[model samples]
Target: MSQRLVVGITGATGAAYGLRLLRRGRELGLETHLIVTPAGVLNVHHELGLDRKALEAETSFSHAPGDVGACVASGSFATAAMVVAPCSMKSLAAIAHGFGDNLLTRAADVTLKERRRLILMVRETPFNLAHLRNMTAATEMGAIVFPPLPAFYHRPQTIDELIAESIERVLELAGVAGAAPKAWTGL
Candidate 1:
């Protein structure tokens, strides 16, 4: 079976990151198991103008955020990694605190316990101490807290290019081999 990656899209602002990740994962032939929180569904439509069904159609598999019994929720199910693109503070706190009230958080909790790669693309700014502490806590638990900061050296000509770069880096970190737009060659 192809490598499986669990993608959790939260209510954070940068919905495009999650969308691009799914598209690229499919292109790279990795099986993507997607779970979008209720807020994530709303934000995808609000930010990307894509409805939940359209978002679901982009991935190899889809699970409701409430589906605690999903395969990905179990550590025995082999998966390469998990990424929470545009991870919201609410979700971050839940994961940091080991609160698995729903499938998304439950899967994250499992990812951590299973010693699997867990990446959180936390999309928030003006960090208060609480956010910092949560990030530190998550990091201590082995979750990569990646904030989608733009790389200016690439001189991206469009927003899509920037989003693509973030997706590429996330994939690389997850050990997924795939094509991404060219990286900076260095001056």
Candidate 2:
């Protein structure tokens, strides 16, 4: 059976990562379960020039911000992993503490509990010790906390290239191979 991935996009500024994941994953034949927060919907419109409905139309599985009844909410649904690209601090705290107020958070919790890969692409500046502590706790629970730090070796020229690189990293940790940039041989 083909692998599945949950893509959760929050209010974080870097929304392109999540969108690119869905687009690229679909091309790779991976089923994507997507969830967008209210603010995320607005961000897409303001940033990507796509409205919430239009964005959802392009996804395999899409749900409202706090919709807990989404199909991916259960662990028996079969998934390779979950990716929260551009994860907000609020959602990060939720996942760290096992708070499942929403389907996205709940799905991440279930992924962690199921011993599956849970990639968190946190996108916030000026983080504090508490944030670091929360990240430490989540890491102990098997969630990969990847802040939106870009790499220079890729020699990316446009913003899209940078975002694609980050999503590619998350996909690697999710066990979805062949998604990362070509092997970096020592120059």
For each candidate in turn, the TM-score is 0.97, 0.94
lDDT of each: 0.94, 0.85
C-alpha lDDT (0 to 100) for residue 59 of candidate 1: 98
Off by over 4 Å in 1: 179-184
Provide the lDDT at 36 for model 1: 98
Best model per lDDT: 1
How many clashes show up per model? 0, 0
- Candidate 2 per-residue lDDT, tens place, 1-187, comes to 6789899989888888888988888877887888888878887788889888787776777776577877788878889999997788889999999999988899999999999999999877788887888889899999999987878896989988888887777788888956765457888
Candidate 1 has which clashing residue pairs, if any? none
Model 1 C-alpha lDDT per residue in residues 1-187, reported as the tens digit of each score: 8989999999999999999999999989999999999999999999999999999999999999888999988999999999999899999999999999999999999999999999999988988899999999999999999999988787889999899988898898898866465667767
